[model samples]
Target: MNIFDLLLEADILVQISIFILLGFSILSWSVIFHRVFTLNIAHKKLKLFENEFWSGIDLASLYQKSLSRRNKLNGAEQIFYVGFKEFSKLYQMKRCSSETIISRTLDTMHTAINIELKTLEDYIPLIGTIGSISPYLGLFGTVLGIMHVFVELGKTTNNTATQIIHLQIIAPGIAESLIATAIGLFVAIPSVMAFNYLTTQINNLDQDYNNFIDEFITILYRQIFLNIDSVLNKENKHEETENKTCY
Candidate 1:
């Protein structure tokens, strides 16, 4: 007969274990599909944002674009917005030193990065947990099923003919219980594979974010240097005009 028939004929405990594993299987698959789509979108957005960010657009304009889509920002775009917004505020104040401004900007970006990464990694642990424990749970059911079969066999003190008939029933019953182990492996294998693959994608996204942060910081430094030089040139022009007037 089919596995469904075997399941129907299984002991009560084995049935319960199978049901639990089935639930785990369902939930794990749901998470797997949801996470796959979500991560795929995240990676695509990351690539698009990287291209736009490095196209030599000014920070203020890029920041404005990000602000307009505040609801959709993710990965490097979110971090850039956070860092640039803080940098703009502090730079406008003119009181904070460059070191303090950069430090605060970096801190803000780091915090945003952590938040985005955490959101990306949500529910991944559930997949991992299911993968790790489903097999052991199935084995527990298998062990119980075998123990039950042997106990039944032990009680048969009748003639070999009756005992043989008893074993005919016991054999299928034990095989039915081992189905739990099979189901466990079924649930575990895909979940483990999905967990590892999704984690790797998340890690790659994080690395992209880090690289953008470093590049943005360098860009900010160059902007700050140019601003300082411009201000110094203005002061020099003013001094020269004053000297000419005095003479």
Candidate 2:
């Protein structure tokens, strides 16, 4: 029989269970598709930004470019911009030592990473919820359907015709009830797979961000030493010129 026929014949509780499962299935699929697209974009954007960042370009130029695309800035770019801006401000102020500037910059990047993680993980729980609850929803429908069939069977008398008719009814009802379980599995398997895959991707990105932070700190340290060296060299050169003139 058609799905409409089975749905029409289902007990009220079974119908309710089926409808609820259907709703869950729709919402879970939506979350899956949305997350796929968003994460893909995030990965691509990060790769593009990383290539630019490591190309030996100046931080000021990178920061200006990032600012121009502020609305479209991805996770890595956003973190870099926030950390760089803070670093520049603190360095120029000359109020904090090099260590303090690095510490504060790391803190800013950590905060931005947390925010990016939250955005990346949005709606993930919904997929997990669907995976966990869909099977139970289907089982509930099956249990309700079985109970309904037993109740109808009990109503029939000892007449052979009545018993045979009830048996026929039971067969169709049982088949219809099992459809709920099938649908539940259909909803659950993909959700579980998607959840696992997305989780792995996010974790990788998290590690990438952390590594970048450490590498950036090292770059800042080198810049500080280079500046010190340049100043010292200028002083030595000036002193030598004066001594040579006196001699």
Candidate 3:
């Protein structure tokens, strides 16, 4: 029979499977759209933050501006704040060696990065799982329906008399099987796409964080440490000049 005829002739269980597949498709698509929106906003905010960070702008001023906003910022800014706070604290400590200070600064930044990574990745894995499994579940239902159809087909020995029941059984079973593929496609396409897209974004952000961390740390080492050493050397030179003049 024709496709419409098959659909029209499908049994209740097969129809139910189609409905379930459609539901999963809708749910997966919803997740895809939501995540896309979230990630896009995150990237926008992150770019804004990075530009502010590298602009020779004062961290204190930036921190103050960021803190004033109630819904103003994201994890990238938080990571920067944590790093800047550590840098300032170390600067105040005065007694620490440069090695100790830089090491502590990097350690703090790394921890903050890990926390932000987790926050960014929330609920994404579950979306991938739903995408991967929903189709298989649909296929399982279809298989069971087809098996029942065949079992019904085997029940009678008469040829023409059994054929009508066979059509009723087989039509829905075939439709159900085809829908399993459709459901599989429904679940798999967006899921694979979303999973891959999000993963790539995470990697890019991670690289951006690492690069910025290195650049900012290098800036601190040059500006803070060299200035301190220069002042100390000048003081020693002047003291020696005074001693020579007095002698």
Best-fitting candidate, scored by TM-score: 1
lDDT of 2 by residue, 108-165 (tens): 9999999999999999988998899999889989988888888888889999998998
User: How high is each candidate's TM-score?
Assistant: 0.89, 0.86, 0.80
Highest lDDT: give the candidate number: 1
Clashing pairs in 3: none
- For candidate 2, what is the TM-score? 0.86
lDDT of 1: 0.86
Please provide the root mean square deviation of candidate 3 (C-alpha atoms, Å). Answer: 7.3
Off by over 4 Å in 2: 2-4, 159-161, 225-247
Superposition error at 199 for model 1 (Å): 1.1
Model 2 C-alpha RMSD to native:
7.9
Candidates 2 and 3, the one with greater TM-score: 2
Local distance difference test scores for all models: 0.86, 0.83, 0.72
Clashing pairs in 2: none
